[model samples]
Target: MTEHVDVIVVGAGISGIGTGYHLQARCPDRTYMILEGRAAMGGTWDLFRYPGIRSDSDMHTLGFAFHPWTAAKSIADGPSIRAYVEETAREYGIDRKIRYGHHVKSAAWSTEDARWTVEATGPDGPVTLTCNFLSMCAGYYNYAKAYSPEFDGADSFAGRIVHPQFWPEDLDYSGKRVVVIGSGATAVTLVPTMAQTAAHVTMLQRSPTYIVARPGEDRVANWLRGKLPSKAAYGITRWKNVLMGMFFYRLARKKPAKVKERMIGMVRDHLGPDYDVATHFTPRYNPWDQRVCLVPDGDLFAAINAGNASIVTDTIARITPDGIRLDSGKDLPADVIVTATGLELQLMSGVAFSLDGQPIELAGRLQYKGMMFDGVPNLSSTFGYTNASWTLKADLTAIYMCRLLNTMTKRGLRQATPYNDDPTMKSESFLDFTSGYVQRAAASLPTQGERKPWKLNQNYALDVLALKFGSIDDAMRFSNPGRSKDGRSTDAGTLQTA
Candidate 1:
């Protein structure tokens, strides 16, 4: 007999592990297994080994709600974040439920059976499993590939070129000139950290990006932790951060000029008035149009002030044998060129999805509640907030899924599908952000409807009300009770569609 479970969660990352914990606590009767493609547990944290790799968002929010982050540093490093995730899994015994090296190839949903036939490739070979529900926790990036743009003379460059996604273990850059290409988070992080031991570092960007400086440690959170319990302090700090983030986001959206001025002014304060802040730090777009890069304790600014690192605002003409030639007739010499280019965005973990042997094109479908797809049954994908800590939204999603499962069990329903009946509903891109990665993958992602339930608020407070307290029956249609693969009812009566 083939293996079967009540729920199958793909990817054992933060989302998967958190989902596992919620399932154990809220739905104890349901059997679930996590299938991880990688050998390790930590998804992004484990894969990214670049220097100074850390969470851009605060740990109090990035960390799971069930597990309080007791560390002093609000902004945590990659290794520490990975360890925190591993510890959370062990504490909840979610690790034991995980099957490593199990790469889910595809999932086929059967309406008659009211279950998903999940196919994966394990170490032993092909493995098939049946599940009542499928949860896609796999992250939004292409793990196998990073977005590496082609430079005209990249092949002629004699120096070692590296992408942050696949950082080589033994590669050394001590006392060597390094040139990091990009103005995004990865480039900002690499420039400062690499400047510590490097002879000189230059951050070459096609255009400037908004960069912010913040303290690595949270004073309020640390003080609260000392006075109150771990969980209590964490909760307070989490709300504090969430509200503050929301306020700033709203302010930015409402008054883009004011927010942009304040952000640029802060950068000017860090670098002296003598510095060319206009050319090096100013971005043409409004605040929050793209993600603003955060540097802990103003390390990137300090590096530049110390003469160890410099920022060049110019387009890359081509890659030279020993350096990069700029379009503005300037040459940046370097022994190592680090391509801190963005990630290749992926949806549904790149898994081929089908409904009753009919191919499911995610782009054509509409997103329901930011998790489930319109007309898709018994499936949910955990996609975190782009503006705030990913886990803040992810934690809520897990809780909502549990509520959904419990409701189905109570109603004697085996399938819950969100169907869009509004013919006039206008469709928009899944995400409104104009980030390079998001824009690149816009066509491949699902669309969101203009109105409620189908539209994404992206605000945690609003999402909490909608996902947690809102009616699950709003747009969802439930059917199929105790039905077999051949459509024969195994129960006393057929379930009426609701």
Candidate 2:
């Protein structure tokens, strides 16, 4: 027998937890369950167990609005972050609603019934659950696949290879020559931290990434917290970082040259004048074009300067028993290899779904206000900012979703969908990116358009006003209950349609 509920939330990450919390808070009597694929509650934080894994943004902005992060350090490591998420769920009674080990395989929307039929796989057996609403919070990154570049002799390597996502706890790298691939956030983060213990750590990359150095702690906020109330201090810090992020983003987009020069200056300041800045720190593209990697206190550069770490920028020819062979004919020997070669993001985590018995191609659908999809009613995905803090956008999304739900309940509606009649519309990406992961799966996911709701503006300033203060009527199409699923229904709330 299939169980029925008011809503079904996929994944138990911050997004899923936040959504479930909001839904329950708005409609206390409504029943909802969270289906998490993993065994634990913390999603990304739990998955990545690498050394020095932490937030690029400060905790003040990265943390939830309702929950103020009281950590002394602004930049929190993975363990602290995981603890915070678990704490939030526990405090809000969200942990009780989560069904761990339950992975959603497919969902089918019935137009006749105006409900979604979801099938999931669990440890016990396959369970079927029917719900009036299906909210996807699976996140963008693919949990299973880690990008390990195919080297000609990768099979011949004698040493153990590890990805940050799947690093074993028992593995040791002390006094060993380790080479880390890629220069993104993960690689940059691992290099310095590993150099501390590892005898020698070589950070190899095909091209340089734009690096920004910021103090690990928010000085002003730290001082204010000591002098004023924690709430006021946190609020002030959150907006300060938000506005600073916005200014820099606009500067990068509008005045690219000036921002580039300033970034170069930062690199020069961190790594003395004698070091070659162009080869390692300077990126080919503009800052924020690809997400910039952040280093607290320039630790990565400091490690290189101290001769504990080295930077290699040659193409990989193959892997050997000893180490990696570069395309430039230079062989870098290592005892252990760390493949930090980016992430493979599978939007919605390959969960199959169809709307009204018709296959819903996410790319072909119009995005309603960059959060909700057109032609798909009563649902929205919480996609965070690629360039900014994830929780900043997520907090706004949760608030907006709650507002929409409350509005519907007040107006006596049951369902809502986005309506679009533009025939010339085409699929586009939400981010201005050229990453391998996004380009590879462009055909399967939701595509952004050239304008307005279709264009995903990653600006927090605009998103704040749009999501927090914008009128729901401007984007959402509201309707009253004229016909019920059983052909006999009464008006309880307003239902919006696509």
Candidate 3:
């Protein structure tokens, strides 16, 4: 016999924890379980153990709206963030609801029964579970593997090569010359942190990336905590950061050239006039097309100024036994090479899906309000904002899902799905950004319609009005076992489940 739950939440990460909290808080009568592939809590925080791993966004916004972040530092380290997530789980008894090492292999929805029969591989062997609703909080990328591009002659390198995603526990780079390949957030973070002890560190990139410096300790948040209550302080800081982030993002989109100049000029001010800003700091693409890297207190620049770190802008020709050979004919000498390459994009945790024996092709389906896919019933996903704090969107999504569940119960609906009625609407990429991970996963991602309810605007304020307060009836039809799959009203009374 298969165990059954009101809802099955995949993945026990930040998003999953938030989902569990909301379900318990808002819909206490419902039963749910979080299935985690890994054996631990704190999803990304536990997975990544690199030297300087930290939240790119401030904790004020990264933290759930229900929980107020009381830390002094706005930019927190990996361990601290991990503890925060764990604490939240323990506080809400969500820790008891998580089943570790349960990898969900597939989810099959039955229209006749109005349930999802999920298959998984647990430690004991194959496991079966069923749920009325499926919540996907497994994140957007592959957890089992990082995106490792082929570097010519990489096998010939003598020193230990490490990827930031899967850093070794005992690997040591202290007092050794290290070369970090790539210019993304991971690389920028690793450079300064490793530079603290490493003999010398170099950040080598094929092209430049926009980077900004901010104070690690937020004075405003600290001051507010001293005067106001913790929750009050957290709320104010969260909005402040949100508005500022939006202002900068809007400015970048409206005046790309001016924003580009301003961003480059900030680097010059930090690294002095003599540093090669154009070659190392100025990217070819416009700002906001790709995410801008953030460094707290200009630590990366301080490392460069201290002669502990340096930046190189060039592509790799190949890896030699001694070091990396750039296409520009420069050989970066290194005792160890750290590949800060990005993550592999994975949709639905590579889980197979079927509807009444028919395989579900998600790629061809249209995204419904960035969470639900068209034609897929009793399923919702948590996809956070790319430009703002991830929790900002996750919190709203969790709250909205609970509200939806309550509505379904009140209306006597067994199944709800988004149905696209506008045939003439244009199709766009699901995500609005131009990041490499997104571009690589374009073929696998769902399509977004050109208008509201089908499209996803990265703006949180608009999403608040639409997702939080907007009607769930439009573009979405609710149905019960008595009604047809298209949600046609019927007098047949068989069962009611939402």
Candidate 4:
């Protein structure tokens, strides 16, 4: 017999855990299950194991609002992050609801039954489950593969080569020359931390990324947390961070020149006069075009100043047995190589979905409120903001979803999805910006529509104001239109024809 639940959350990351927690708390009578792809939880944290892999944002804001992160350090490492995820799940008792090793292969929506049939592979064999709703909390990036460009003679390199995503546990790099490829967040992060113990660290990048320095500790929040109650302190802290992030984002978009100058000035102040800040730190695009790498306490620059690290901006021709041959005819010798190359982001890992026996090509469909796929009845996904704390957005998504579910149950609504006449709505893309990974997988993902719910805006305050406090009718479409007369439309919000 196939099991049935009110909701089936895919992926046990922060997003999934958050959603499960909210669902359990709000609707204890409603049955829900979480399907995790891996054997354990902590999606990104468990996967990234390189040295000094930590949160780019402050832990105070990065962690959940319902559950406070009590880590001593403001910036936490990967293990700490993983522990936090696990702890949150355990503390909320959501961990017990997880069915580990159950990877959802496909899901088909039955319009007649108004339920989703989820097909998954588990330890025993193929299993099918029915759920009233299907929610994806899998995140944007694909965990299986990291992007490592094939340089000539990559395999010919004598040293042990490792990607930050799948870093070797036993491989030691003590007192050894290390070459960290790419100037993105991961490379920048690896450079300083690896320099602490390695013989020398070189951050090699073809193009530069915008790097900015921010204090790890939220000074105002720390003071407030000490002075006020925990809940009040967290509320104040969250709003403070949210407003700041929104203000800066708006400044960058509106007054780009001033923001650009300030960003450049910050880099110059940290790197000093002699350093070629323009060549390395200056980005070709606008400040939020790509994610701005956050340097806490000026640690990355400090390592560079200490003569332990060097930033090299040059094209790599190929790898040699002894070293990497640059296009400038310079050779950077390394005992170990770390490719912090970006991620390979695939939406839902190419998971197939069918609605009423028609295959759904997400790229052609619209995205509703940047959370749920249009035409994907009774489904939603948790994709956090590229800027600000991810948890802030995740928390909002959880709340909104729970509210929607509660409203549905009250009204006797069976299903809900974005109702759009134009299938080719040009405004479905959540992210308007372009990057290597995002662009490559664009065709495989859902399209962005031109209007409000279909178009994704990353503004934290705007989204929170809309998603949390706003009316549901503006963005959501609810229905129990075709149910029999005997079937009660118990919920008032559930749309019914006169």
Candidate 1 lDDT over 1-498, as tens digits, reads: 889999999989999999999999999999999999999999999999999999899999999988999999999999999999999999999999999999999999887688999999999999999999999999999999999999999998888999999999998999999999999989988898999999999999888999999999999999999999999999999999999999999999999999999999999999999999999999999999888889999999999999999999899999999899988888899899999989999986899989888988888589989999987889999999988989988888898999999999998888888888779999998788888999888889899988888889999999999888888788887776465678675433433332
Q: Kindly give the number of clashing pairs for every candidate.
A: 0, 14, 0, 13
Q: Which candidate has the highest lDDT of all?
A: 1
Q: Model 2 over residues 1-498: C-alpha lDDT tens digits?
A: 779997888989988888877877767867899999999987898899999999888889888777788888888899999999999999999999999999889888775566789899999999899987788888888898976667788778998888898989998999899999888999999999999999999999999888888888878988989998889888988999999888888889999999999998888898889888888778888888888888988889889889999999878988999999898999999999999987877767777879767877777566777778887767778888987898777767777777777776787665666666567767566766766566676676676777765677788888878877877775456655345667864434444332
Task: Name the better of 3 and 4 by lDDT.
Answer: 3
Candidate 4 lDDT by residue in tens digits, 125-186: 89899999888888888788888888899888899889998888898998999999988889
The lDDT values for all models are 0.92, 0.83, 0.89, 0.83
For candidate 3, write residues 314-412 as lDDT tens digits. Answer: 889999999999888989998899998899988779899998789999985888888998878889988888888888898888888888899888977
What's the C-alpha lDDT at position 473 in model 4?
62
Q: Candidate 3 overall Cα lDDT vs. reference?
A: 0.89
Tell me model 2's lDDT, rounded to 2 decimals: 0.83
Candidates 1 and 3 compared: the better one by lDDT is: 1
Candidate 3 ranges beyond 4 A from true positions: 482-498
Which pairs clash (backbone N, Cα, C closer than 3 Å) in model 1?
none
Better of 1 and 2 by TM-score: 1
Residue 87 local lDDT, model 1: 100
